[model samples]
Target: MAKLALLVATFALAFLVVNASIYRSGHSSCERQIRQEDNLRHCQKYLEEECSDSPYNRPGRYLDSCCQQLENLERECRCEGLQHAVRQQLEEGEWEREEARELFQVAKTILRKCPNFEEPRRCEMQSRRWF
Candidate 1:
C-alpha cells in the first residue's frame, strides 16, 4: 500500500507540472497578442493623423511623417496591421478600389524607406479588382 501511494503521488506531481507549464505558456501567448494589438492601434493612429495629409499622388512628400511612424512599429507586425487595415477598408466600402490600392502602395513605400525596416517575406498586396 505504501508503494502504491508513492506511485500515485508521483503521477499527480507530473500532472501538476504539465498543467502549470501549459497554463504559463497559454498566458504568455495571450499577453503577446494583446501587445501586438496595441502596437497595431498605435500604428493606425499615426497613419491617420500624420500620413493621411500627405497623400501618395506626389513623390517624396508621401514619406514625410510616415517614415517616423513606421520606424516606431515592429516591422512584421506593422505589415500585418497595414494589410488588415486595407482589407477592412475595402470590404467595408470605406474607400474606393483605387484609393485602397494607393494606400497600400504608400504603406509599402514607407516600409521600404524606413531605416532598419525589413519587409515581411509573406506580405503580399491583394490583387486589384474592378468594382
Candidate 2:
C-alpha cells in the first residue's frame, strides 16, 4: 500500500514538472510576441515623425533614406503582415521615383534657405529624373 502511494506521488511530481516547463516556454513566447509588436509600433511612429513635415509627405519625392529606414525597420520588426506590406511599397520602382522627386524638392528648399545646404547630395534619389 505504501509503495503504491509513493508511485502516485512520483507520477504527480513528474506531471507537474512537465506542465511547469511547458508553461514557462509558452510564457516566454508570449513575452517575445509582445516585444515584437511593441517594436513594430515604435518603428511606425518613427516613420511618421520623420515624414511629418518632410517632402515625403508631399506630392513629389520619396524620402530615400526614410524609405530605406522603413525597410530596415520592417526587417527588424519581423511581424509578418506589417513587414510584407512595407517591403512591397518600398520595393516598387514607381514609388521610389516619386520619393526621389519629393526629395529633390526638399533639397531645393533647403538649398534656398541655407545656400550651403551641404547635404543635398544625400537627398538626391537617383531612381529616375521626372524632368
TM-score of each: 0.41, 0.31
lDDT per residue, candidate 1, 1-131, as tens digits? Answer: 99999999999999999999998886565445535555344434433433344454344543434445445545544565556545544554555555656656655544655566656533465545524
Highest TM-score, which number? 1
RMSD of each: 8.2, 15.1
Per-candidate total of colliding backbone pairs: 0, 6
Worst lDDT run of 10 residues, candidate 2, spans: 73-82
lDDT of 1 at 58: 44
Q: How accurate locally, in lDDT, is each candidate?
A: 0.54, 0.42
Give the poorly placed runs of model 1, Cα more than 4 Å off: 1-35, 45-76, 91-93, 118-123, 128-131
What TM-score would you give candidate 1 relative to the actual structure? Answer: 0.41
In candidate 2, residue 7 scores what lDDT?
Answer: 100
State the lDDT of candidate 2 residue by residue for 7-114, as single tens digits. Answer: 999999999999999988865664455344543343333333333454545432333433333344322232332333333334443444445344334432322232
Candidate number of the best lDDT: 1
